[model samples]
Each structure stands twice: as C-alpha cells, then as structure tokens.
Target chain A: MERVVTINLNGNAWQLDEAAYDALRAYLGAAEAGLKDNPDRAEILSDLEQAIADKCSVVLGPRKSVVSAGEMQAILKEMGPVTDSEGFAEGAAPKPPVDVEKRLYRLRQGAWFAGVCSGIGAFFKIDPTIVRVIFVIAALITQGAALLVYLVMMFVVPSAETSEEWAAAHGLPFNAQEIIDTAKKRFGEVAENQNRMWKSAQKPPREPKVNAFVSPVQKPAAGYGARMFAGVVASVCALAEAVIGLGVIFVVWSLFTTGAVLGVEAPDAWPLWGVIIGVVVASAFVTWPLRAARRAAFGALGYDAAGSEAAFSFFAFIFTVGGVWYAFQYWPAARDVIEPIWLWFRAIIAPGGF
Target chain B: MNPDEKFAPLRKGLLEFAILKVISGPAVYAADILARLQGTDFATQEGTLYPLLSRLRRDELVDYEWQESQAGPPRKYYRLTEMGRAHLDDLQAYWRGLNQTLDNLGTFGGA
Candidate 1:
C-alpha cells in the first residue's frame, strides 16, 4: 500500500500519494524560486496554488479519491514551468542557468554569541573556532572594542532562517533540487562538528550544551523586516539606559564626595549633612525610573516586565515620601547652601562685576 | 535543432500580447483566460499566466478585483487599464506594419 499524504492547496484539501506530494511541493518551490526577483511573488504564488487546487478537483472523482503520482506529473507538465517575465509555453527550451549571489548571514543553528564569528567563518570558508579565537584576541588587544563590534554585527547582520538564505549563506545554488538537498542535512554535519570542537576545547570536564548561551530566550523565527525592527528598538533602549545609568551614578558620586570632604572639615556643618542626605534620597527616586525603563526594554523583547516594575514602584514610592519628609526637617540647612550659589549665579549674570 | 526550441522565444513574447488582447475585451478570470488560449499557439500553463498577470498589475497595465466564484475560493478577475489599452493599440499597429513589410518583401526581391 502506498502512503497517502493530505495537503491544503489554497483553501481546498486533497490527498495525494507521498511521491506526488513531494513533486507538487518541489514544483511550487521552483515557481517561487523563479519569481524571487518579482515584487508580487506572494500574490502570484497564491494564484498558482489556487490554480493547482482547481486542477486537482477536476482530477478527483467518486472512484478515485486520491491523486496519483502519474496524475500529478501530467498536471505539472500541463501547467509548465514559470520563467522570468514569460509565464508558460508548450515544450519551451530549457531555462538558462541564473547566477546566484552568496551573502553573509548569521547561522542560527550553530551560533555561540549572536553568530557573528560563525557568519564570518561561513562567508570566508574558515573554521568558526579560528574566527572566535581571532575575535577574542582582537577584543583583548582593542580593550573590548571588538566585543562592541560583535554587538553591532549582531544587530546589522540578518540570521539565516529560510531555505533560500541558508543556501545563499553556504554559497550553494538556490534551485529546487539544491534546496531539497540543503534544507535537510547539508548544514547538519558542519553544526555537529562545531559543537564537538567547542565541547572538546572547554578545560573543565562538564556537559556542554551546544547552544548553551543562545538557546535560552531564543527569539521566534521572524521575517527579515520584523527582526531588523526589533534590533533597532532594542539598540535604542540600550543606549538610553546607558546614558541614564551613567548620569545617575555621576550625580551620586559627586554629591557623596563633596559632602564627605566638607563634613570632615567642619563637624557642625548642617548644609554638608543635607547634601549627603539628599544624595541618598535622590538615588531612590532615580532607581525607580531606571528600573521602569529596564522593564520597558525587557517587555519589548517578549519578557515579563511586571515583576520588576511592581517591586521597584513600591520601594520608590516609600523612599520618595521619606525623602520629602527629611527635606522639610532640613529646610534651614538647604537654604544656607542655596544662598551663596544664588548670589554667585546673580553676580555672574550682572553687566558689571559685583 | 527542434522546431519547438526555434520558436520558443517568439511564442513567449507573443503570449503577453495575446493575454492583453483577451483581457481587453472583458474582465476575465485567470482560468477563463487559460481556457480561451488552450490548444492555441500561445497556450500556456497557469503557472506562467499568474506571474505575467502580476507583472502586468505591477506595471499598472492591468488591475484585478476579487469576485466570488461558484467553486472554491474567490477568483481574481482582471481587466485592462487605460495604459494597457494604449499599449495594446501600439502593439497592434506595429504588428500590422510588420505584416505589411513581410507581404511587400517579394516586390523588392533584390536578394
């Protein structure tokens, strides 16, 4: 008994022999490859699917429930191969060999950290381990500048997810026959070799997960556009966080140092005490927004932001209120420090020297 | 060389013109267009027609609307645009000019 496979063509369903299903899928794939340059590829594919479905319905009868492999051959032969610009012609000459351009893309399968080094390796046909070693050496020599370059590459370079991209990444022709061969086990051997090499290199005797760093929170397969959009958003969020974090740390550090110096010189200086207290209180208020900003950044990457946001909000509200109360008690001390600064500011703005 | 291989490029070129002529009359579905061309010199597969139709639509030469079909899903009914009509007119004129040139070739039998 021959194996029958059920397939959904357009909106209609049909059962075909296993061989027939493969043939039909390959035919459609070839058509897709042929129309790769066309802007209306999706629409044309949908049209082609519907046409194939219509033809299948005509072939099906009360006696013949399943479409045979021979029938499928006839149908595909009748439909003819899709060529660029020209749709179909009877007994047309064989299609000329089209040039396939190789592209550099991060391979998601054997990625260590965002697949930057591996992608470079694949492009240049070098061992990924060698590329990783070079990157580590470069990063050390440049004082972590190369690590920053890796981060930038992760954002700029696309991850090869589709069959066409995978084929292109390996410098293989993206034809129907090639796609079928490459899509299955072409990269499997390379990925396995990389894993073995990586595991062996580790000094400690421990189980090493192939994608240990990347597997956790691995992003869902998204189109190139969606992936690029997420990368841009994440980069912006990261930049903003760095700026805010640095600014807060700077403010806290200067205030603490100034207060400590003045307080040590004059034990009775209430203004210096106020400066120290203000720094402590201000950090609490600052922490809230930083945490919230972090939560927003995490939330954009499909992570749960509620836990951190709620915890920080509770502590921030309490600290802000306590700081407000402390400010009232140290009103005189704050005024003492403000008076000289206000006078200095006014003197600098005056037309003549005071 | 095979006769089919000889005229393949010529037939492929004429297929689009035939499609434009077919759609210029009425808003025809892809299936209807295929049926009309069946057994003709320019007869083509649905695979070929769809992409060509898409290209025509992209060029603003043809536009399609989804119409409810009696069988299966909604069908795309394609009609010629104003630009397409003008393009067809030019092709027709050029074709007649070529026919005239061919017919009058015997008169200038210098070869």
Candidate 2:
C-alpha cells in the first residue's frame, strides 16, 4: 500500500499519496518561482490553493478518498505551465536575467565509483586522477582515515543530476543541450555496465567472464604508479589532519591543567579567572581558523560550505581581541606559569635539554 | 510563425478586456469565468488567471468580495470596477478601429 500524507489547503484537509504530495509541492514551487515579479504573489498563491482544494474535493468520493499520483499529475497538468499570459508590460524596461552562481556538485561522468574525486577535480580545475591519487596516499597515511572521509563525502555531496547542476559544478554558464547530452551519455554507460553485470551473474562463475565485465571500467588515462603515489600522499594528509586534531586537544588539556596548578600555587596573584578566560579565548582563536580551513577544504572537495566561513571568522576575531587583551594585562604572570611547562615539554621531546 | 505562436500575444492582450466584459454585468466567481472561457481562444489556467486578476485589483480596475462557498473555502466574487469599465470601453473602441483597418486592408493586389 502507498503511504498517504494529509495536506491542509485553503482550510480543507485532503489526503494524498506520498508521490502526489511531492508532485504538488514541486508544482507549487515552480508556480511561486514564475510569480517572482508579481506584486500580489501571496494572494494569487492562496487563490490557486483554494482552486486546487475545490478540484480535489470534486474528485474525491467514498471509493477514492485519497488523491493518487496519476490524479495529482493530471491535476497539475490541468493547472498548465504556471506562467502569466500578460506578465510583462510593453513599456517597462527589461530586467537582466539573474546570474547563476557556481556551486559544487559531484560529477557523474568519468567517475570510477561515486564521482567524489571527479567532483573535487572539477571544482579545483584539476585532473580527477590527481584527486584519486591524493586520496589513496591520505588513506595510507592515516591508516584508512582518508577512506572513511571519502565514504562520508560520497554520502554527503549531491551528484549533479540536471544539465544546469552539471554546468554549475564546472563553474560554467548553462549550455543546455550539450551538457544534457554528456549527462545522458554518462548514465547510458552506467546502465550498460549494470546490464553486463546482470548478464554475467546469470552465467556460471568463470575467470574470463569476470574479466570481460571488468575490462570496460578500467581507464588507461592515468598511470598505475601515479595512482599509487597519490594513495601515499592522501594517507599522509589524513595523518596530518589527525595529528593536528590530537595536538589541539592536548594543548587545551595542558592549558587548563597549568591554570589549575597556578591557581593553587598563588590564588591571589595569579588572577585565576583571567588566566582561564585568556586560555579559553586564545585556544578558540587557533581552533576556529582550523575549522574554517577544514570547511574551505571541504568546499574544494565539492561539498556545500553553506557560507560558514563568515561565522567562523567573526568568532575568531572576537577571541583574538580577548586573547590579545589578556596577553597584555597579564603577560608577566602568564609567562611565569608557561616557562616551567615549556622546559618540561622540551625535556620530554628532546632529552638532554638545551 | 505557427498560427498559435503568432496569435498568443494577441489573445493575451485581449484577455483582460474579455474578463472585464465577463464580470461587467454581475459579480462572477473565478471558476465561473474559467468555465465561460473554456473551449474558447481566451481559455487559460488558474495559474495564469489568478495573477492577472490580482494585477487588475492592484490597478484598481477590478475588485473582489469574499463569498462563502458550500464546496470549500470562501471564494472571491470578482466584478469590474468603474475604472475597469472605462478601460474596457477604450480597448473596445481601439479593437473596432483595428478590425475596420484589417477589413479595409484585405486583398493587397500589389507587393
């Protein structure tokens, strides 16, 4: 049985199947978009909803209480192309079309797996093979941490479905027919591969059959050695990210412990509150930038950044000011606490301390 | 150009006049107007009609009053305003002149 959703339209409650609801929502969205320039947009939208509700009531009876997907499709079709016939005034100046901004979308064409690397390559104007190679290296260095990251990315990043999305992914202007053809070709290849797999699965297991199925997938464009090197590099970068993460945690712990020790030693002189505040703020200054950098990196890897850098930067600025203020006011006291810790840290890292 | 494409703009231009005429005599619900226009050249969808009606209201050419409907929510009973009637008269005059010109210009013997 199909799932049904209850929707309130113009003070009437109507039950519609899930597909019908989705279609209705999309149709309304398109209508809204088309009415962007209209002054009484809300009033017209409500009127349209009322009309739709009346239509639904007329169709619904005892046997067919809920609107099916086919009925919803037909209803929307009856609504026609949601555009004003007398939209533009002849004397009015023509407004320039809004520019389409570049956005990150995973490329499906020439993709080995989920097109994550290809997406990243498109975003950065680099070769997809290079991205693949780097990912491999990172996975090796971080002991599969990079692989985990890739898996997460595959799920997170949206694949380019439309020609406009494909164009946006490549930071190009919308060229409809050509981009559509390319996307169709990519999907065709995928379908062909799936068909081959299905055919092979029906046959008895054989080495040559498996080879035949796999041969089409492998591209001869990138060298085997290059991919290996990329794997090493990707692993190394992943390792670096992990190390930096660990380093920040350690630093935070050490700062807090040192503040506690100093408070017990000289509670009055130490200004324990000031030291704690300073440490917290200063540590945030470091971590916030790191987080922003990570977001930028993700953006490069074809993930929507959601304009998070501004928020990160704002906090970073506030913390930096606070940190600097504390450093000036309590420099001597802070130095006294940190000097011993510095010596101890040096001694551990480089025995026979300088 | 295809006949449909060539006449689309003309039909659109005349739609407001046609609507004004439809409601000139009596306050008509939107669906009633659509029903009247069905199977005619000026036939359109709710998507197009609502916005056009709203624009007419904004221009003070048409006004609607809330009328409770037995079927669903309250409907907008639309009627042409005094200004809309005046505008319709001017448009009809212009249309008559165009028709006369077309009839007189028919059968061009020379290029």
Candidate 3:
C-alpha cells in the first residue's frame, strides 16, 4: 500500500504515490540546485517541469492517472542521470551537479555559527577547519570584535541554498559528489532531530510534504538583493520614525511655551487649541506609517507581530480618520494664517514664483 | 590506471567542442544532444555533461530557450552563441594544425 498525494504542477493537478513523489521532488530539487547560477533559472525550471509533465502524460496515457515509483525511475532514466563533469566520483555514481556561480554564500546545512568559514574556505580553496582556526585566532587578537563582524556578515553574506552554492562556498567545483553525499548523511540526522521536533509540534514542520531530496536545511535564504531591499526599508522606516517623534516633541513644546512652530505664528496658541489639534493630527499621520513600516520589516523575515500589531492597527486606523477630519477643519483657518507665510516662503524658496 | 580514467579529461575537454559542433547546426534539447553524442567517442553521462553545459552558458558560449514539447515539460533547446561559434572555429583550426604536425612527425621518420 502506498500513500497517494495530490500536487499542483504548472497549474495542473497530479496524484503521485509517496515514493514516486519523493523521487520526482528530489529530481526537480537537484535541477533547481544545478541551475541556481543561471540567470534564467525561473524559465529553465519551469520549462523542465513542463517537459516532465508532458513526458508523464505520454507515459501514463490519458487512462492511467496515478504516477508510480517505477514510472518515476523510468522518467529519471529517460532524462538521463545528472552526474559529475568528470566521469569519476569518489563515492556513489555522482549526485546531480549544480554549477553555481563561483562566489561565496554561507550554507546553513552544515553550519555551526554561520556559513562564513565554509564560504571563506570555498572562496580561497582551503579546508573549513583551517578557516575556523583562523577565525578563532583573529577573534582572540581583535578582542572578540570578529564575533561582532561575524554577526554583521551573517546578514551581509547570503547563505547557500543549493548544493552547487555549498560547493562553491567551500572552494570546490560545484560538480561535487562529496557535498551531496555529506548532505544525504547530514540530512538523516537533521530529519531525525526534526522528526522529534515535529512530534513535539515546536513549530510548523519546515519540510514540504513531498520532497525527500530537498532537505529542510538546504532551503535558500532570501538572496542578498532581497536582504538589501529589506534593509533599506528598515532604515527608511527608522528615519521616518525619528523625524516624526521629533516633530511631535517640537509641536508639544510649541503649544505649551510659544505661539508658533518653525518661526511661523500659530492661529490659536493654547495647548488644546486648533493649531495644537492640527499638530496632534499630523503626529498621528506619521505614527500610522511608522507602525506599518515595522510590520513590513518583520514581514521580510516571514514573521508577524502578535499583540502589539493589533493595537497599532487600531491606533493607525483612528489617526487616519482623525487626521482627515483635522485637515478638513484646519485648512480654512490654516490657509488664512499661511497666506503671508506663503509669500515669505516663496521669497526664500522660489524668487522666480514671487 | 584504468583506460576510462585516463581518457575522461581528454573526452571532457573535447565534449565542450563536440556540444558546440553538434548544436551549431540546429537547436536541440539536452537529451537530444546526448543522444547525438552517443555511438561517438565523446559520449558522456548526463551528470557529467550538465555542468559543462552550465560552464558553456556562464562563459557566454551557449544560450538556451524553453521550447514547448509534446512530452511532459518544456524542453531546454540549446544553441551556440556568437562567441561559441567563433570558439568552435578556433578549436577546429587548432585540431587540424595539430593533426598535420603529428602526421608530418610520423612521415619524417618513416619516409
């Protein structure tokens, strides 16, 4: 008896026996790993999938629907085994080759602290053990500053997601039999540990239901491009938050002590008066995006805010409504007060307009 | 050393030249290229050839397109690039020159 699972491939539904599904998943996973360095990877992978689907349709025929393990093996054979560039492999008939770009990316699959040592080892074509020793000595000489640098690099340097990247990081040709063999070995231990965690329900199982070839640890982090984009968003949000906070402080001080803001006289000077109300409204306007931006930062990490997010959503909602109401009310009063100031601003900013 | 081991790198080097030569005529998928190479001295395992194909692409010697096939998935139909054609021409000229030199060496002693 076999477990049959339904999967959607290129928008079509496929029912595959568990073992057959695992084999197919692994094959695709290997293809993905192999082509990661290719610029047109998405198109290549999709084309590969389409070809497989077309072949399976012919093999299975319209009458036969269930994809069997034997059929899967036949498909793999027909596609031809992905092996090393050189005919020989140290271990088993070489696993599929992933020709990743010759660049450094930390692999989390076998990492202890970070994949930095592994990446450095790969880039320089040295043993990772030697790199580790060098790091330790460097850290000792630098009074533990290297550890901080390591933390920065953890985010700065992208982690290896594919076998090819892993190989390239460790200074080996991406056509690596040993890396896959080690991955298979390390995967069993990881699966055992994860199985225990899965049984405990520590968090949702990270592994997809079908793929045996894709170890959870081999999952690629967001590319460096994506990380940099998120970093920029975070910095922009922080700057916006700071500017808003300062604006609020200055507005409060203006309402309490003086009749003006940025040297412009307020129409109503009291702490609870119209100008103060408008400033409060403007403060809420900034608060709305500040909370939303923090959520965007967490969204980049695949996380969501639990308790504080709900409060922020409510606060942002209220301010959005209040900000609109205050702006409408104050525009008439504010417009009159700003007429002379506008002329003064035009003289300073755009003498041409004046 | 095994004969196969001795011949592997020699075959591997020429396979790059071979792939460009075969695909230089008409665009073909990976399996098609392999099938053409079969029954030839440079026939290789699928595992071995993919990385070479990858290298060729990286070197800008080849480019591929996903052509819809009657079979399961869209096939990656590979063809030689401008650089690859120029490279293949150079390799052919080098081989012809080398073969002439080697043949002349044998004739110099025997004749």
The per-model DockQ list reads 0.31, 0.30, 0.17
Residue lDDT tens for model 3, A1-354? 345656656656666765455555556555555554566555444545555665677667678888876686576656654443333323234444444457767655455655678777767778888988999999889766676566546545666654344545654433344434444544454345432211222222244222122122323345556754654554445445545764676566655655666577766434457667778787888678776876575355333354224323433443444443444456876444445545666988998894
Candidate 3 on B10-105: residue-level lDDT in tens? Answer: 665676778889889889887788789888988765545666676678789999998887745566789999999999999999989877887788
Ranking by DockQ: 1, 2, 3
TM-score of chain A of each: 0.43, 0.28, 0.35
Candidates 1 and 2, the one with greater lDDT: 1
Please tell me which predicted candidate would have the highest lDDT against the true structure.
1
Task: Output the TM-score of candidate 2.
Answer: 0.44
Candidate 2 regions exceeding 4 Å error are A85-354, B106-111
Tell me how far the alpha carbon of residue A77 in candidate 3 is from the true structure, in angstroms, after superposition.
3.8
lDDT of 1 by residue, B1-111 (tens): 898878777877788899999999879999889899998988877767887888888889999999998877888899999999999999999999888887888786632
Q: What's the best-to-worst order under TM-score? A: 2, 1, 3
Model 2: iRMSD?
2.9
Off by over 4 Å in 3: A9-12, A30-51, A78-354, B1-5, B45-51, B65-76, B109-111
In model 1, what are the clashing residue pairs, if there are any?
Answer: A87-B48
